[model samples]
Target: MDRLIEAIEDKQNPSVVGLDPTPALVPVQVMDAYHIEADEYVEDDDDNLAATGAAAAYFEYNRAIIDAVADIVPAVKPQIAMYEALGPAGVDCYTMTCQYAREQGLYVIGDVKRGDIGSTAAAYAKHLSGFDGADVWHEDAITINPYLGSDGIEPFTAAAGETDRDLFILVRTSNPSSAQIQELELADGARVYEHVADLVEQWGADTIGRFGYARTGAVVGATHPEEGAALRARMPHTFFLVPGYGAQGGTAQSVAGMFDRDGSGAIVNSSRGIIGAWRDDPRYSETLEAQTALDLVAANARAAAEDMRDQLRVALA
Candidate 1:
């Protein structure tokens, strides 16, 4: 966690761009270039051609975003689903994105949310976190699901210890319907999330990092300010991957409590709000929504990152 905290302090920013690119958000020019670049790999297979082209598009868009904001932000969390949406080639895009981000000296939090038991869990624990092998998909950290209980949680923590990496356990998510499951009351008088938070604390107890926080952090959504604050008190030693900002309606004021008073324990994430800003934000209104100039596309992303940094700075101040 010292590595992660160092990046945060170096950039003076606590948020990471979620490189969750979609065709709708990507400029058509980039897509056309992708298809052309895929020509070498296409040969005779139509399906492979389409997948290759789409994968190329995603990779290029993600690379541009990375190049744009790498210096200002500590990391990039490429929501695996975005790449997984494209099938095998999509997975290739996911791994390739990881490789490129690391090359740029940025950290990565794989938004996989994987959870299982026994050997299956152990396998995921080995492959997902830590960049020990040549496989580029190895991430700096990954989000994990705690539904299967401690058995599911221990494997990832073990994996985290093997490297200076981490795992963000899903305690309370940001979605509107998260409560239906995460907020259920247990017989012990603790809410479901509170129970999960306690599990996160227990799991990370042996692995506190150089930053005085644990490698096993919690995914407590900033959307629930009160709940986020309470979880902050409960898991003082855990870091937080606070999502639901920007596109999901989370604000600086809402997520302020997700951090320690020192403002070093959380990393906020803004996905569509930053990646799709060429379309969604008024500041970039004049830019063409389709086939944007690559430089302008990246420039806008950098601006959005700076703006997010400022917002957090104001809140923390």
Candidate 2:
């Protein structure tokens, strides 16, 4: 787990590329190359053949993105909905994607965000912890929803203890609707999320890695920069996963406060803004394969990440 944390820290740019592949959103030429049919794509009620095709398409897209940006970024977060909707074949692709990412020296954070109780949560831990099976395991880390509070989180914590893995508790999400519940003022005047943040810090305290940061982390949305900064201050030793940076309209400057003076303790995630940029990019208009659309998007991502990192460096200086 320490090695996982250290890998991101060493990169200086703590940007995690989200591999969110939407069949309709991918470039037309790319889709045409695969000859992917709309009927074969993921639907609310996809049969096995449709599901298998969708999963295969997702696997190919993820592989291409990973090959392009793995060296530049710290980690890749594969959204579970996109994969799970495709069913078992999708699960197989998910497992392969994790394996491929590890081979490329990038951490795989399964964006499962699973929340349950007792045995079910433990089963999810086994499916995700990377220690259960040598082939299908994703060892880096998995996202956990803390809506059920300590009871929901305890099982993940216990699983981390067994596998030497880690968990990122969703304290503050980037979604706009999140404020309705997360910002509810508690009896003690602290917001509901603040209480969640406090618990995250405490749970992470016992799991501090070799570095000053702890393995337990909180998912603080970049949309709420001030609140994100407040959480950072409260849990100085905890790691942060800052989403909503790119497509969600969060600027690089807005997310600067989430990191330490050394540009550590946080990783900013962007999905549609990077991978989907090619569709709207003027430079990508000239030639799809000949030009570097993916490369350009990846470069821009690296630049955005580094720019945010440099802002912290300048602030500290």
Clash count, one per candidate: 1, 0
> TM-scores of all models?
0.94, 0.85
| Off by more than 4 A, model 2 | 32-47, 130-132, 283-317
Can you tell me which runs of candidate 1 are displaced by over 4 Å? 128-136, 280-292
- Candidate lDDT values, in order: 0.86, 0.75
Write one digit per residue (lDDT tens) for candidate 2, span 50-97. 567666666666776787777667788888787777777778878888
Q: Flag clash pairs in model 1.
A: 28-291
lDDT of 1 by residue, 17-52 (tens): 999988788777777777887887676767677678
Which residue pairs clash within candidate 2? none
Candidate closest to the true structure, highest lDDT: 1
* Model 2 lDDT at residue 310: 57
